[model samples]
Target: MTEQLEKLNRLPLRDDLRGLTPYGAPQLDVPILLNVNENTHGLPQEVQDAITASVQRAVSGLNRYPDREFTELRTRLAGYLGHGLGIENIWAGNGSNEVLQQILQAFGGPGRTAMSFPPTYSMYPLLASGTGTRYVTGDRAADFTLSAESAAEQVRAAAPNIVFLCTPNNPTGTALGLDVVEAVYEAGTASDAIVIVDEAYAEFSHAGTPSALELLPGRERLIVSRTMSKAFALAGARLGYLAAAPEVTDALRLVRLPYHLSAVTQATANAALAHADALLANVEDIKVQRDRIVAELTELGLQPAASDANFVFFGGVEDPKRIWQGLLEAGVLIRDVGIPGHLRVTAGTEAETTAFLTRLRELLGA
Candidate 1:
C-alpha cells in the first residue's frame, strides 16, 4: 500500500461506518418535493428584500470575519425562544447536526456511549460513531411510542455519557410526551448523562405540548437543540442553536471553530427572525396539510401514526417500494424509513399535497 493508504488504515475508523456512505438527503428537482421535511414556503418578498438590504449594507465589512461569539444572533434567538434560558445559555453551530456532534465530542468518546431510541433520527448513530463512542439503542415498542421504562433501564444499565432524544421524531413523526422526556432526563440524571433533546420540528407540534426548555431550570444536563432549517424556512442559511445550562454551552464553545457563522448567514437569519410571524403562519398551514394527509392515508386503509410534526408516517403494506416507485415515476418524491413497510410523506404546498394524494390513491388502487 502507498504511504498515505497505509497511514489511513492504521487509524481506528469506527467499524460501524466502514461500509456506510456519508449521510445526505436526495436533492433532485421534481414535480413535488415531499421527501426532505422542508417548509414548502420560501421567505416572503419583504423578508428577502430586507435580507438583501442587510447584505448590501454590510458588503464593506466582507473583508472582516464575523463575530466569533455571534452575540447579536444569539440575543435574537434567545428572544425568539421566549424561555428563561438567555443568551448566556445559548450556543450556535453550522447546523444542528454540528451541535449534536459537539455534544458528543464534549461528553462522549472512546469508552463512553451515546444512548438513543431506534426508528428515530438516523444521525444519532452516525454522530456517535464519528465521535468514537459506542451507540446504544433502546428500541421503541411496537406502536412507535418510546418505552420510558425500558429506555430508563437501558440508561441505568449502559450508563452512557450522553443521551439523544428527538421530539416529533424524524421519519416516524412521533412526538414523545413531556412526561416521557422528564422520565428520560431524570434517568439520565441518575447516571450523570447529558440528555440532548433534538426539537427540530417543535414549531409543527400540536398545541399544549411542552417544550424541553420548560425542563431546563432543574435539569442541568438537558440540552435542547433548535434549527431554523425546518419551521423558520432558513435551511439554506445553515443555522442551529442549542439552549442549556451555561456550563454545557461553555463546553460546546470549547470545540466549535471560531467564526462558524458567516456574515451572510447571520444576516439572513436575523432577517428570518424579523419575519417570525410569517414563518409561523406558514407552519400553521403545514400543520393543516399534515392533518389532511394523515386522514387521507387512513382512508386508504393505511394506519398513519398521529403526527404533530410536518410529516406523516404510515405502515401496513408489505412492500411500500411499489408506492414509493409509483410516486417517484409520477414526479413526486417522499422518504422511505427503515421500518419495514413504513414510509414518511412530508407536507408541502396545497397543490403538491393534492398531486401526492392523487398519485397515492391511484397506486393503492383506491
Candidate 2:
C-alpha cells in the first residue's frame, strides 16, 4: 500500500491538488458515535415503511433516466420550506456539497475568489479548489463568533465573488446572527458577491431563532443551503437542497449535470417528507442532550462554545489528540477538529450522552 501510494504521487497531478489531503473525519466503530453530528435516533417506523414502499415503486424505473428537472422533488422540498418559495427557487444535488460546487461553477472560477470565516466547514475550501476558485478565509473572534462589523470589514477587504457563512458552524457549534448576514450582504453589494448561508443544522438551533429563509424576500444574491442529512437522519439518502431567488436556481440549472437526482433518490426523499412530523419527533430530545453536554463540560472547567447546532465544541485541553485517544480506548468516538485545545461531539441518544460524559469525566479524573 505504501509503495503504490508513493508511485501514484509521482504521476502527473494538478498543481493545486498535488499536496492537498482529502477531507475526512475519523470513522471508527465504537460503543457510542458522537463524532459526525448525526442523529442517533432514527426514523419513526411509519416513515421507514413509507420510504421503503416509495423506493420499491421507483425500482421499476431503473431502466429509464430519472427526471431531468427533478420537478416533483423540488416542489415537495419547496413546500416543506414554506417561505413563499416555488419550484424555481429550489435546487437539490447528491448532497449540499455538490449543490455548493454547482454554485461555484456558476459564479466562481480562476479569476474569482470564495471567502469564508473559519474555523467553519472544512469543505468550503476544498469545494473552491475543486472548482478552480481561489479560496480565502477571514478570522473570527477568540470565542469563534463573527460580529456584523467584523464580517462587513472582511467582506470589504476580500471583495470575493463568493462568500460562505456556515451558521451553526461546523467544528465550532456557534451560529451567526442575522445581523452578520445582513452586514455582509450590504458590504459585499459593491463587490457583486453571492452570499451563501449554510444552514445544514438549522433545525437543531434553539427555538425562536429565525432562519435565513426569513431573510430571502428581497435579497437576490442571498442563498440558504440546507440538508435532510443532519436532523432528518437521512445522511444515507444524500439529499441536500438550497433556497434562493428563481433566477439563482435558474443559473444553477445551466451548470448541474442533466438528471443528477435519480428516481430512487427522489422517491425516498419525497416519502420521508410526507412523514416529516414523525421523523422529526426526536429533535426536542436531542436538544436536551446537547444542552446537557454543554453544562456538564463547563462544570468540568472546560469552556464550551455556546452552540446552536447538534454538537458542542469545547476547549481547555492541554493535548487534544491525547484526550481523543483516551476516549477512543474507552470505546467512544468524537472529533478532534485540529483546533489547539478543542474537540467536537455530536448529540446522540440520552444513554449515549451519559456514556460519553461518564468516559470523559473518568479520563479527566473529574
The Cα local distance difference test for each model comes to 0.86, 0.91
Candidate 1 residue-wise lDDT, 135-240, digit = tens: 8888778887886787777778777788888988887888887777788877777678999899999999999988888889877899999999999888888989
User: Compared to the true structure, candidate 1 yields what TM-score?
Assistant: 0.94
Report lDDT (Cα) of residue 163, candidate 2: 98
Please identify model 2 stretches exceeding 4 Å from their true place: none
- For model 2, residues 267-345, the per-residue Cα lDDT tens digits are 9899988888877778888989999999999999898988899999999987788889988988889999888999999
Candidate 2 lDDT score relative to the true structure: 0.91
Candidate topping TM-score:
2
How much lDDT does candidate 1 score? 0.86
Query: Candidate 1: lDDT of 96?
Result: 95
Candidate 1: which stretches are off by over 4 Å? 1-17
**TM-scores of the candidates in the order shown:** 0.94, 0.97
lDDT of 1 at 299: 91
In model 1, what lDDT does residue 153 have?
Answer: 74
